[model samples]
Target: MASSVTKEISYEELKALVGKSQNLLLVDVRTKDEVDKGRISGSVNIPVDSVEAAFAMEPEAFKAKYGVTKPPLDAPELVFHCQMGKRGGTATNTACKLGYVNARNYAGAYKEWCEKEGK
Candidate 1:
């Protein structure tokens, strides 16, 4: 896979998206245990280590596993996050490598989500 610049989204922008019913997929790269505590309301968990494989799966298989449609390669809004930001960056890179050109990292991640939500 070729190296590619990882795009990022700000907390403000993410908050706006979450408030809308737009075509968005927020992939949480946290472990099940961590995610079990809480997450951005509409996000999905697909642990960091499995990002590449998850994106590689056929759409049907992905849907079966993730319970959401597998985003297409050209999906306009594919965002990844984790406890903080590091793993989110890693997952974004992985997606970019697989040709998800619009994939982005939520730089503030779940911690920022909780803080902003006053959790």
Candidate 2:
């Protein structure tokens, strides 16, 4: 695994990123059942269990299914989140291994987001 595979961001930093980056890709790496309870608005659904599968299969297939487009080095960041940030961090690491330079893990994932969003 690359050293840059893990990049964690605070909730405030995440909010700032969202505010500034229109092209940001916010991904929720949680189970379908968990997501049914509640999730951040506009976050793409990608179950954590399936991440390894995506990497095992064709990378482009995963990208297409998730609507992720390849961007230049200066492209907007890709933010991932999960129930408590563990899965999100894992996903971010995997994404980085697959060449996503701007992959970031939202440390205060759905749990913190929900509290802050007053859910």
Candidate 3:
């Protein structure tokens, strides 16, 4: 069973994890239009509304649809973010319920990312 505790990721921690590539899956829970404006590089857009179904997909099906391999239940780190973080927190909860034990929300989100990056 997955823990009930909600996990969160800091911008500094997320920043450090970004370049390692293989160790984490960055999921953006913002809409495609919002994501079009900008997003944390290396993050995949998976609008919050579709999160449950998306995670339920067969790995091949998910990859075919999203163009990225689906992270397994035990994936090292499955990080979610949105423009300001609320949706990301919701997505994180959804993922956790689906057995993504390592799921975390980037509480700072893209807004913080942009501010930190001076954009």
Q: Find the 10 residues in a row with the least total lDDT in model 3.
A: 1-10
lDDT of 2: 0.78
**Every candidate's lDDT:** 0.91, 0.78, 0.91
Lowest lDDT 10-mer window, candidate 1? 1-10
Backbone clash pairs for candidate 1 read none
List model 2 lDDT by residue over 1-119, tens digit each. 32555888888887776656778778889999999998887788889877656644564776788776534434456788999988998888887777777878898899998888788
Give per-model TM-scores.
0.94, 0.78, 0.94
Return the lDDT, model 3, position 116: 97
C-alpha RMSD of candidate 1: 2.3
| Per-residue lDDT of candidate 3, residues 8-108 (tens digit) | 99999999899785878899999999999998889989999999999999999999998899998999889999998788989999999999999999989
Q: Report the number of clashing residue pairs per model.
A: 0, 0, 0
lDDT of 1 at 27: 96
Alpha carbon lDDT at 7, candidate 1: 88
Q: What CA root-mean-square deviation does each model show from the true structure?
A: 2.3, 3.4, 2.8
